[model samples]
Target: MTSQNSRQTLIIPALGGLYARLNDGVETLLRVIAGGFLAVHGSGKIVDPFGASEMVEGLGFYPGAFWSPLLAATEFFGGILIALGLLTRPAAFAGMIVLLVTVWFHWVTMGQGFSGAEKSLLWAAALAFFVVRGGNRHSIDARLGKAF
Candidate 1:
């Protein structure tokens, strides 16, 4: 076989195998990035717990007392869970909901449209993917042999 043919048959397949082997690690990395961002971004609210009350209420979620801490927990604790790959689906699903709400707030209430809401939209999509795919083999869920 020619050199090019050998490269295709050998190198390409080896690369493919490597990619498959690292797929779980890639998923874990993405989860860490997303979850870590959420945790850091929400850290302030977690400290106060009521910091987002007015904003959340302004978004029409009323009873700020309830939602304020709930949102805080979802971002903080939920982020921790996601990063640890423990109960990933539920955490990601909750994060998805929070991000969607932010998307609406930015797009509709703030009149920022897609430009302002783009980050939340992307975060929501990432959370949604985790919600569906669950934790990969490198995750705690996989170690426990249960995703839900």
Candidate 2:
């Protein structure tokens, strides 16, 4: 090819346009899936006293075992925010932290594999995307004049 033709091809918009679309599709799916998973996990804590208390003790997140309600609330509300694509950057950051911790837990019990640790890795990647992208378009933040 000529130099000019090669330059045009290099800058062609179609050069992997399909792949970019696929990535967007995957991102949308992850937004839904991660949001739903977080909602359920938070709801579980609310419904199960034992589970909540056990989490407080097991995780030792609080200085003096101040109950798991704080974490539960973060999960539930953060999930909702992410689902609506409102305040997505902060929500995704928090969700990424949770996923990373989950990965550590799975690594201990489930060992290294696609069935366990890899799930957390993927969750981290998805959440990180939202954190960096801030929910692109068609999000609550965008519709409400607050997408950032």
Candidate 3:
């Protein structure tokens, strides 16, 4: 049987063997860290789910009462789902949307430009990655033999 390393080497004549072994672990690490931080960041907001009503309303998401709780849940619960690798794609997509809004808020609303929105842009990129990759083999989605 061809081992994973050997297959990797065949696919890429150099470096693949060395790096392929770490792919899943690194992906998992990134996912966990991103999701964990997102959850923590949203923890305070989730505590008072309606607190961001005015803020979301400012963003044009009518009915601040509805958007506020949704924003909180998307950050907190979606973060948990991402971290657990359950429904990873949808969760990451939600995160990406939130990050995109932050990017807009910082760059356009606050007029901070790239300097202020850089972090949110980076986060959006990471979540975008997860949205496309849909978790690695070590994820719950993989174990369940399905992903979305």
Q: Which candidate number maximizes lDDT? A: 3
Instruction: List model 3 lDDT by residue over 59-79, tens digit each.
Output: 889899999999999999999
Single out the weakest 10-residue window by summed lDDT for candidate 3.
1-10
- In model 1, pairs of residues that clash are none
10 residues in a row with least lDDT, candidate 2: 1-10
The regions of model 2 sitting more than 4 angstroms off are 1-26, 48-50, 63-67, 108-115
User: How do the candidates rank by TM-score, highest first?
Assistant: 3, 1, 2
Backbone clash tally for model 3?
Answer: 0
Which of the two, 2 or 3, has more TM-score? 3
Per-residue lDDT for 60-126 in model 1, tens only? Answer: 8889989999999999999988988999999999999999999998999899999999999999999
What lDDT does candidate 3 reach at residue 100? 100
Give a tens-digit lDDT track for model 2, residues 26-82: 666678677778777778765653456565566555532345665676677778888
Q: Pick the candidate with the highest TM-score.
A: 3
The local distance difference test score of model 3 is: 0.91
Q: What is the lDDT of residue 21 in candidate 1?
A: 68
Q: lDDT for model 1, please.
A: 0.89
Q: What local lDDT does model 1 show for residue 15? A: 74
| Model 1 clashing-pair count | 0
Can you tell me which runs of candidate 3 are displaced by over 4 Å?
A: 1-15
